[model samples]
Target: MSQIVAAIDLRVVQLEKQGVTGMALANQMMGHMADLQMIYNTASDRDLRKLCQRFPGFGRYAMLMEEVSEQNQTMAMSGTHPYGDLPDLPEPLKTALVHVLRAAADLERDFQATADDGRGDNQGRLTTARWRWADDLEKLIYQFQSAELPLQTQALVQQIIKATAERIGRMG
Candidate 1:
């Protein structure tokens, strides 16, 4: 399970790096984003930890992964960061931001759906997932506007924001 989780995470990192490097969006781009959220859910908990004594090998790596995950969470929360230093990009490249934003939204929805059902899931995981999505969305909006992003990118961002707002409106 951990190995599969690691593979998904690596794919997410690769996609992110590829986008930053101005790679063309391939057919698997959307599927890759969905897989990332799925992996996050899979590796995030350890109900079996309390059942067994330390399995030495798994214990060590789990601890290491937990720490790495914490650091990534921290970076995601710190609003003024990560992709801030990117150079001015063309319409095609900047449009890729939509994928990042959509992935965040998908993660939030996935977590919230589980959390709301109260199906013996960890509340902390759900709360943190939602917070991460909200914080990252805000940061993405700031970064998108701060840069001289192309008109097409601006339009895409606007559409996402509008759609999200409408969804929220319906809930109320």
Candidate 2:
């Protein structure tokens, strides 16, 4: 198990060093992400210490991922960010992603930029971002539904959507 994890760590590092980007990096990480999510889901609290021991950066890495996921949910509920996490996602979902991002950017430039008071303070910001979030959900659902995802992956994606939407709805 140690050797296997060491190999995975080495491979990911090597890939990072190779400067993979955009759709390519997304495609590669999809497998690892799926597997990691599966293991993470199944891990008992008692198993956590062993997992951290097995993966040198597991704790910090997982925390950061959770933080990012939370931030994404916050953005969906609150407002459009000036910058996107990634301007693009990998196909076969890129088409939908690009369209939604463009729409959000257009809103930011046209309405958010011109607001006398800061747009962030206004409900318009939340409205615009939610528009994009709606697009985000639609596209992602299509992507997930169409993909040959494992059961664990499908469940995880569903959980993410359901949780984020539920939280955002509660804020309204």
**Whose TM-score is greatest here?**
1
Reference-based lDDT, residue 104, model 2: 33
Worst 10 residues of 2 by lDDT: 104-113
lDDT of 2 by residue, 2-112 (tens): 443443344344445567444443333332444456557777766756766666544434444566667768886676743333333356554554444334333322332
Per-residue alpha-carbon lDDT of model 1 for 1-172, expressed as tens digits? 4543343344333434445212222222232444444544654345336311233323333344455456657776785445434445556444545555455445534443454566746556655755665676677677768768656657755675656544433322
Tell me the alpha-carbon RMSD of every candidate. Answer: 14.1, 17.7
Best by lDDT: 2
CA RMSD (A), model 2:
17.7
Find the 10 residues in a row with the least total lDDT in model 1: 20-29
- Runs of candidate 1 exceeding 4 Å displacement: 1-99, 105-109, 112-120, 164-172
Candidate 1 residue 139 Cα shift, in angstroms, is 1.2
Indicate the TM-score of model 1.
0.37
lDDT of each: 0.47, 0.51
